[model samples]
Target: MTADKIKAAALAHFANHGYSGASLSGIASDVGIKTPSIYAHFKNKDELFLAVTEEAIAREWEQATAYFKNRSSSFKEKLYGFLRSQKENYDEDERAKFWLRTSYFPPEHLHDQVMKDVYNLLDKMETLLLQEFKEAKEQEPQLNSLNIEHAAKAYIALLDGVFVELLYGGERRTEERLEASWYMYERALFS
Candidate 1:
């Protein structure tokens, strides 16, 4: 339970402050423990940071799995929902914030390690979306000429663009970007 509590506090601190800015002392203080108490659960700050990062990645992956697992939603709903969830989650979820921040703005010292994790997620995401797009192309005659791989990559590109807007473009801009991106995405798939 101490470890879990520590991770919870660490996640918040990391989400708010980032890898370089987050502190074990501050995390421990938030957890109502001494700085040294953290050593009982983590060897060092890098270890603790990675622990939190790994947990965030797992949580995000699970969310995506849940979205893709639902059998009832039409592909368009599922696909758009996935894109929209990026904004919703970033705005409303702390774990999502940490995942986004760490994925894009990792600590310079941990860049290689952080990127390894990010690339693994990207590969998995592409594989899943590619399958979904392939199925969509099969199910919708409108998508007869759609190139599934290109669509998948473009979709992820749109998602990445949305990520940039979310981080710095403010709420109105992020919404506008999402709306425009979705419109273009729909045109690409349906036109």
Candidate 2:
């Protein structure tokens, strides 16, 4: 569909150029349309950017959390898998790049709008993590001593730290950080 093509082009441009540098004209050129055709799909660049951003955020969140739904994996496995998968996503996925870039460096005018979605996603992440931690503790005697709320918060913090490393530290450094953080997390949960 034309709309999908428009969005896809916008994603690449916005990812490479950032908000102010990306333009409707360029996006339209990529889509083989004139600048005004974009208006039919998106009211303005802001609307298009936010749409692409929110979509990327939602997709990234779903991908990052997919491990939690594994019926066969243990909770610890789920946590480790999440960290590994997120690292892969950051390294390979354009959407992840866009999501991370927009999240940290949103256009000045759209900061509030961007944060609103981001905060909602964070809240959802925390709640799901808390629930999973509680269930895992119930199932794993070793985890009974670990407070689920604290564990959830710590896990979220761990995720943030790992993401920061990947964003600035390259694949190798990110892998190093992931392993080290997992070790500490495992020790704390079991100790």
Candidate 3:
């Protein structure tokens, strides 16, 4: 329970302040404990950060798994649903924002591990998408002309662009951008 509270506080702090700016002292204060107590749960800030990162990734994977398990019928519907759901899932929330911020702007010392996490998630995403695309192709021979690998790459790139937009583009514009971009992407791929 204390460890969870510590992690929750750390996630919010890191999301708002970035790595160097966040402090164990502050996290302890938020958790209503002394700084040293944090050491009971986490060896150091690095460990805590990585733990939080892992938790965030796990949360995302769980969400995606649930979404895909109960996903739509058509291939386009599945793709669009997953894409839009990500935007909804990650927008401005503490855990998601912390994960996104750390992913793109990790502390210099943890760059390699952060990137590894990114690659791991991407691989998982691609695997899921490839399965869907292959199934779609099997169902409609017309889609067989669409290269699954290429489509997966393009879709990941589109998702990355949306993440970048979320960081820089204000909330008001994000939905509009997503709609317009999704339309263009669908047209280019399907039409």
Best by lDDT: 1
Off by over 4 Å in 3: none
Q: Measure candidate 1: CA RMSD.
A: 0.9
Off by over 4 Å in 1: none
lDDT tens digits, residues 164-188, model 1? 9988899999999999989988877
10 residues in a row with least lDDT, candidate 3: 64-73
With a 3 Å backbone cut-off (N, CA, C), the pairs that clash in candidate 3 are: none
**Best candidate per TM-score, number?**
1
**What would you estimate as the lDDT of candidate 1?**
0.91
For residue 80, model 3's alpha carbon misses the true position, in angstroms, by 1.3
* lDDT by residue (tens digit), candidate 2, 1-191: 99899999999888888999999999999999999999988999999999899789879677657767777987788888888887887777778878888888899999999988888888889998998988988899988787788889999999998989977898788888989999999888976
Q: Mind sharing the TM-score for model 2?
A: 0.94
**What's the TM-score of every candidate structure?**
0.97, 0.94, 0.93
lDDT of 2 at 116: 88
Relative to the true structure, how large is the alpha-carbon lDDT of every model? 0.91, 0.87, 0.86
| 1 against 2, candidate with superior lDDT | 1
2 versus 3: better lDDT goes to: 2
| Residue 23 local lDDT, model 1 | 86
